[model samples]
Target: MKISANQTKNSLFQKIEQVRHRQGKVRDSHITLAHGSGGKAMRDLIDDIFVSNFDNPILSQLEDQASLNLASLMQQGDRLALTTDSYVVDPLFFPSSDIGELAINGTVNDLAVSGAKPLYLTCSVILEEGLPVETLRRVAASMKKAALKAGIKIVTGDTKVVHRGAADKLFINTAGVGVIPKEVNISAHNIQPGDLVIINGELGNHGAAILIARGELALETNIESDCQPLHDLVETILKVCPDIHAMRDATRGGLATVLNEFALSSQVGIRINEESIPVREEVKGVCEILGLDPLYLANEGKLVVVVGQENAENVLSAMKSHPSGKNACIIGEVIPSPPGIVLLKTAFNAERIVDMLVGEQLPRIC
Candidate 1:
């Protein structure tokens, strides 16, 4: 049988992806502005590359709007949860995700970690004057798709253009509103000494992927930003266990920063099993190569959940069954022994203090 040229190229690309995935390396030499332009290049990039790897029903629809039914939303609460975030990821585009998607996911995750059902969002963009309009359209469309997938609506938006050097091609800011049941009380102060510390998935992929994509560090590994909106995952978990003590999305400062904040807020110590934490092999390699610690890296999609010890298993199970929570695990537990301290039990049978980031390690990493 003979295959068409497109098929031949796709097959070759798939084979290349297979090897890269197995070895954890990206073959792209560098990113060009054309990749963002909404033309054949952009479509091919999304279809032949990103969709091929991160394919999902929500993302595959490739539609202008994603229809959602919110008939049951009213019963949750009368008050709404609101959050806003700005994406200034320097390159704008990275291995696994881009700034537009990050803006949506970050804002949605903020509401999700707060135990809210995300509903509506407003997007504002700052574009370099010289940037192609097509690029802006694709990003806008991507944001629309992401919002739809998360069952949220982008009811309003604004766009502004800056001088070429004033902005780095593009920056996206989003504000989101969500509703939480009045009875659902999840807060840092609610955490207890006996509560368990759970993480939804592996850490540090986003930071390291950004580093590699920009060619800042020379390392051979296949990793991409674990960027996704977590509202659905949060919804599923809350439905099963509404009594979650506290939740936080480990973003700019990774697990250590969030843990430290939680520890201080609850006036309790946290003891984590280093061995229990999940770190992808490629991410580990990148961290080792760059002399970076995964604990302090940024993550856009993953969350830290603190629940009663007895409910830990149920929460982990609930998270694991969800697509976003496949690698969810119990990494640590709260304790009263050392108030406001985060202790790490190393794989080598040693203990160390996990401190908050004093200064920036990866500046502008977000």
Candidate 2:
């Protein structure tokens, strides 16, 4: 028997689905320069890569701007925190995240770690002339969704086109506004000897994932970037231990950089127990194979908290309740030692020094 018109229509739809599915296959080891140009290559990159990984309602909408309705009550305080960062990842996109998501999270994390509740954000786009409009839309859409998840708004933005060779395919600069409650205060200068060190979760995942995505180092691991928003987690910690001495997000310089900065700012030393620090076996193995130090590896979602000794358990309890902080642990403490130094206690009872990365290990990674 001949197929009905309805059945013919159904068959056509199935054929279209198969065609779309075939467009996203990843055969190349690295992103070709064509991936950024707003053409067939760029469309494939966004549809197959970004959307597949960060599937969400706001993202699925694929609109020029994400519709949001933030509560006015959330912006009560006169005190506010503002932060900005430029996204310049050499590869632009990585295993777990791209410059788009990183730009959002990076600014939000800075505000969160500073005890501010982020509210509004402004994004500036520098697009290379040949860049595809579709890719730009995808990135803007990602920013909108990330801002919504962080409870912030993309209130204002600007776009500028640059000569093809003058700039990378794209670079994003994001600035955020946040309200700081009068009662909450987190500062590196507030750190004191005898305070305890608590980390939100495992380190090196974001860094390791970036290195692998670059395809330079031949190593394999399941580590994906831990890039995420941290406002909710920060809020919980503040609620339980309102007297927290200091809080910082471990980003570019990793735990070592932030810790050393804190030590210097507070004029104190930090003693970290090697056993207490959390590291995934996969990340550790990758680090070992590459001769990279986990301590200096970057992290996106993780946080470092220094709280008074009496409130350690309270802060830890708060941290554990949040998804981002489920693996939180007391890693070390502030101590009276040589000013601005961080000491690591090894598994073999040996002491070693940990310092800031000289320049950059995995460069252009957020």
RMSD of each: 10.7, 8.8
Compute the lDDT of residue 258 as modeled in candidate 1. Answer: 98
Clashes of each: 4, 1
The Cα local distance difference test for each model comes to 0.79, 0.81
Report the error of model 1 at residue 119, Å. Answer: 0.4
Which residue segments of model 2 deviate by more than 4 Å?
1-75
Off by over 4 Å in 1: 1-75
**Each model's TM-score?**
0.79, 0.80
Write model 2 residue lDDT over 96-215, tens digit each, in one string: 677788899999999988888887776766778666655655675676578668877665554555667888888888888788887887899999999999999999999888888878
lDDT of 1 at 23: 33
In TM-score terms, candidate 1 sits at: 0.79
Residues 1-366 of candidate 1: C-alpha lDDT, one tens digit per residue: 988999999987986775345331223333344444656544554454344333434434555543433565567686678889888886777886787788888998999888888877766666675675556545655766776688776655444556668778778788887888887899999999889999999999898888888876656567889999998898888878899999999999899999999999989999999999999988888778778899999998899999998888988999999999989999988999799999999999899999998887687677
